[model samples]
Target: MNIKTQLKNFYLLQCGQFVSQLGSKITSYGLILWTYDNSGSVLSIALLTICTLIPSILLSFLAGSISDKWDKKNIMIISDSIAAFFSLIVLILLITNSLKIEYIYIINFILGVVDAFQNPASEVAISLIISKENYIRVSGIRSLSNSCITIFYPILSTTIYAFAGLKLIIFIDLATFIFAVLTLIFLVKIPKRIYNTGDNTNILHQCKIGIKYIVNDKGILSLILFMAFVNLIASIYNCNLQPMILSRNGNNKFQLGIVTATIGIAGVIGSILVTIKKESKKKIPVILNIMMFSFSICNTLLGIGRNYYIWTIAVFLGNVLVPFLTANVEFIMRNKVPLEMQGVVFSARNTLQYISIPIGYLLGGVLADKVFEPNVYKISFLTNIVGSGKGAGIALIYIVIGIIGFLGCCIFKLNNDMRNLDN
Candidate 1:
């Protein structure tokens, strides 16, 4: 198909993804708030995170394989259905005041299992069917969808929580899931993936092969590893922001919502830039170097930023580079991996990428609540002589991590193995 036609097809599916993400976000914060209200334990929150993420890490390869072996459209539709049904049950229980945190945990675990399949299927389908000229648009669409979640979720949840209560918001989220499933059913028609004629790998073998490929391919694996490391730090900063703000100036839930909306707005702006001008001229190393630097700077600023406005600005600018990095990484993975192997490869990559999130959250929770909270005064560096407890110590840590990210850029400059592929 021509580029225009491909763009049209890909965007239709993206709309469904957009709806899916919106509801997912609404349900997400509600659950988090519920946990805090019920137990007031960070450990409960951590368990919730582990429950949600463990499936993504373990089933990623398998999910990828199934997506490749089956009809891509059907995979999306089925996954959506699974998610919708689970949300509906939770919604009903919530409305009746029978919902428990355990219920939320169970449903989240199920959703994570489906997510493992849905992610690789949708991403690979875009690269498979869309013309290369329009891949940027696909990337833009994905980024925009994610941005919407960050942007609207806080406001939506708070508004719902105010008058209607959390129960009603769960119902709204259920509706979002249904809309997503119906959109997929009526609109998308993905092609079935076929293995190469000579390939004899079983499902188990296919899973292992993806890991082997990621490991053996030094260039791809290094890029993936570095991406994971950056993500780890980013997640930590995100999770700790609320505590840091609270510790510094007495944080409120309402203000946190606004902060999230700002971050989302920034990401959407970044996606627009990518749509207008995707990566074209620079080598991969150059792109990675810029992305890592930008992320490092953003995180460092967010860590140490005293004023709310400064943190908002830092997050906003941080997002601009994020889409740039995200689009290029997807571009690289799609182009380098074989069609038959795309599912498994992308899954393996996502598995590694997501592994950073739990680790990040753990680190953030620990530092903000325990390590930094008690010893904020003791951990102070000579440079932290002027700043507050949360501000200075956290800022010092961010500076250290930021320097680590920049050093990654320097290391990339020295590596020549991936230069030819990038060019």
Candidate 2:
């Protein structure tokens, strides 16, 4: 396909994706609020996170292998269809007043499984459709889609939830799924899957080969390991964010929405800048490290500052640095990994990086409830700094995680393999 045709097709795909993501984000925020209000425990939110992540952690390798062998468009359509069906089921249960926390856990687990296939399929599809020269710009556009969802979903869902509640959110999600499915079926023409006759047909063997390919590459391997650590730290902050903000804001949904939206606005701005400027040809590592360091500092400020304005600014600045890091990393992957192996390779990368996420969620909750929240009274010196309150312990956790993340970035900077990856 010509470049213009390819761009047109990709934008269509992105439009469909953006609409679907917005709906999903709305549902997610609604569920988070419902679960927290109903259970009134951070652990409940953490369990929900675990249920959502565990499937992706377990099935990513198999999903990636399948993506390489199958039609990407069909995989996406089928996954979205299945997910939509489940969402509809949940909606029905909610309407009937039969929905429970366990139901939400089950639905999220199933959706995670769907994502195992859908994410790799989408990534590989982009690699196939777009020219290498546009990878950075396209990555920015992808970030913009997510940013738009983040920016709108929280406030929109919060407002809708106040009147229509969970059932309406699920219905909205189902509609978006239908829209995405139709777009894939009609508008997006995914290139045919490339098959290698010489390669083994065994799924296990293909997975092994994929792992070997990633591990044998020093640059990719180091980057993956570093990212795993980053995910761990970030996950901790994410798991506690809702509780922290709600605790500080007296559970005001509007206030929480505003704070979250600040991050999204920053993301939109960052994505626009990256899309316009593209990425630096050289100094990729320097850019990546600086962004990471900046993110850590912002995170630290978020932990230390109790004021709403401080919290919003910290979150905004932290998120603003994210697009640059994401675009650069994506560019590296697209350029370094062979097109044929992108599905499996990207899957493997995701699997490894996300392995720490569940651990982080579980640990964050346990530490917040069992350790930090209780111990704040005992440590007068520490309490003097972070203050004494309901969410203060979680705030302390953020500071520690931010420090660890900064140290990790420093270590990453010293990794010659990662620094030289794009060269």
Candidate 3:
């Protein structure tokens, strides 16, 4: 295909994915609202995230190999179909008033499993469709979709949930799922992978090849490790943000929604800049600098600010830098890795980078409940410094996370191996 034709195909695919993602996010937000309303425990929320992450991490190695060996389009369709089926199951349970919190956990786990295969396939498909030169711009456009979803889904879900109910929200999800599937089947065309006729490797061996590739590349290994640490801090920050705001605002979900919306707006702005701006030649510096600023500024503001206004500002600033960071990292990977190996290599990269997320979720939840929440009042200095309140302990945790994240950036910056990726 010509460049213009390829671009057209990718845009169509993005549109379909965008619609599907919006529906998924709507359901996700609705579920969070329901779960929090029922349990009122940070650990419960943490567990929900952990349930999803664990399966994705465990299955990633296999999923990557499968994506490389199988048809990417078929994999995505099957995954989406399975996810829709699960959503149907949830809907039935909700209608019958049998939907328990534990059931949601199960559903999330299944979705996570689907995502392991789906993600790698999707990444490789993008590589197939888009030329290398446009990787950064396309990444930014993808980020824009994500950001738009972030902004829209909360508003959409909250409204539907309030006026109609979770049933209606789920129904909308099903409709979007159908639209996405149809679009994929009819509107987009993904080029076939060019395989070597002599190469006959089992999926398991391909998985090893993926791992070996990363292990042998010191620059890629170090960069992935740095991201893993970043994920640790970022996950903790994400896990606590909702609960903290809810606690401080007397379970005012609107306040939380507003903060989230601000983040999306900022992300949209950032993504726009990333789309128009030239790709950075020094991607390592862009990645590291953005990480340092994001952690230092956003967390500190969130740690100190007691109201939604401050939360909005903090998230906005923090999220705006994220697209820049994300585009650079993606550019580095797409530029360095071969198209045929991306399915497996990207999957391996995900396994390493996201492995810490579950740990962060667990630690954040445990510390919030067992340690920080209980002891914030007792620490006179801490109480005096931040002022003890509903989310006082969580606030303290944010500051600590910020400090750790900044220090991580510094350490990564000094790594010769990671810096070499810039070349």
Candidate 4:
């Protein structure tokens, strides 16, 4: 099949991804709230986030190397099946009334380990379906699909959990995974699963080769660093949004769900915009501006008060910039790397970009409970302008973080090297 046909073929995989991820988003938010409410310890929930990522860091190099060696299609199928089973097992635990914080950690950690394998394989497999020029389109579609889940999962999951239970949510997730698997069986068409052997070497050497590949690419490495800093800010924004809303004590699950899902809804909106936006290398600088300014504005508004409705509006707006930034960033990376080395390059990028996520989780949880919510009750000077709501007092950090993140993005424009690339 041609690349165009492959595009049609793999739409099912994207659909499957959407369903599986939607299930995950719902369960994860529910689990976060459950852990916090039961233990009243945001730190515990944050620790769950930290533990889940540890596996990805440790195993990513090997995962990237293996992605180059294996049948990409089979790898994804196995990964999906295992993850589906993981959700089912969690559902059983919920049914037995044995679910706990430790259980959440275990499940997420396993998913991370599985994802280490899945990410590189999926990236490479998509290339098999599409030619180089069109990978960005496929990726956009995939990102849009991801956004769809984000938009729907929280509201759907929270409402369902409210009426039924977490068990039902997990079951819904399982069903989605099964559907994804079946869809892949019928829709995705990978004609051959062969890797070039003219450059064959030892397995140990393959591992080292992957490592050396990223290490040697200065352009790739620098972009990875830039992303790490940006994502650190992003991670803080993410981990704090729920706690920020829930700080008032009366935050219903639905409110929390909307807060959680708003960014994704924005992403869905952003992805749609990408489809129509005229494609050009120059649009990238505009995207960076959007990232810097929108996030700055979001943090500024978030610090202004404890108004959930207001913050939701801010996040929804920020969502537009984020997906635009993300899609373009992926496009840049796809263009920079060679096919054979894309897995290692991409995984290495992820490893570096994700370095601060754990830190973000730890700091956000601890600070919200210990620092910001406690003594900073009347954070005077600037943020006190709207100091009327429950969380209005400690809004300075939000503005500070947002400003810092925006500045970081701005510096990207000042650098002549990155901007000169497509020229």
Q: Which candidate is the best by lDDT?
A: 3
Task: Compose the digit string of candidate 4's lDDT tens values, residues 1-423.
Answer: 776587776776677667767776777766776676788665787787887787877787778777877888888889888888888888788788888778888888998898889888888777666777675577677778888878787788778877987777777777777787787777777657555322565555666666576677655565677778877887767666666667653667778777668878888778887776777657457657777777778888777756678778888877766667777777778777777777666666777788778878787777766776665645555435545444543355577688888888878777655665455
- What C-alpha lDDT, on a 0 to 100 scale, does residue 137 get in candidate 4? 73
Which segments of candidate 1 are over 4 A away from where they belong?
39-43, 193-200, 246-249, 379-400
Which lDDT values do the candidates have, in the order given?
0.72, 0.85, 0.90, 0.73
Clash pairs for candidate 2: none
- The C-alpha stretches of model 3 lying farther than 4 A from their native spots are 194-199
In angstroms, how far off is 121's CA in candidate 2? 0.8
The residue-by-residue lDDT of candidate 1 on 29-63, one tens digit each, is 77776776686554466557767777977899888
TM-score list, all predictions:
0.89, 0.97, 0.98, 0.92
Better of 2 and 4 by TM-score: 2
Ranking by lDDT: 3, 2, 4, 1
Clashes (N, CA, C under 3 Å) per candidate: 0, 0, 0, 0
For TM-score, the strongest prediction is: 3
Decreasing TM-score order of the candidates: 3, 2, 4, 1
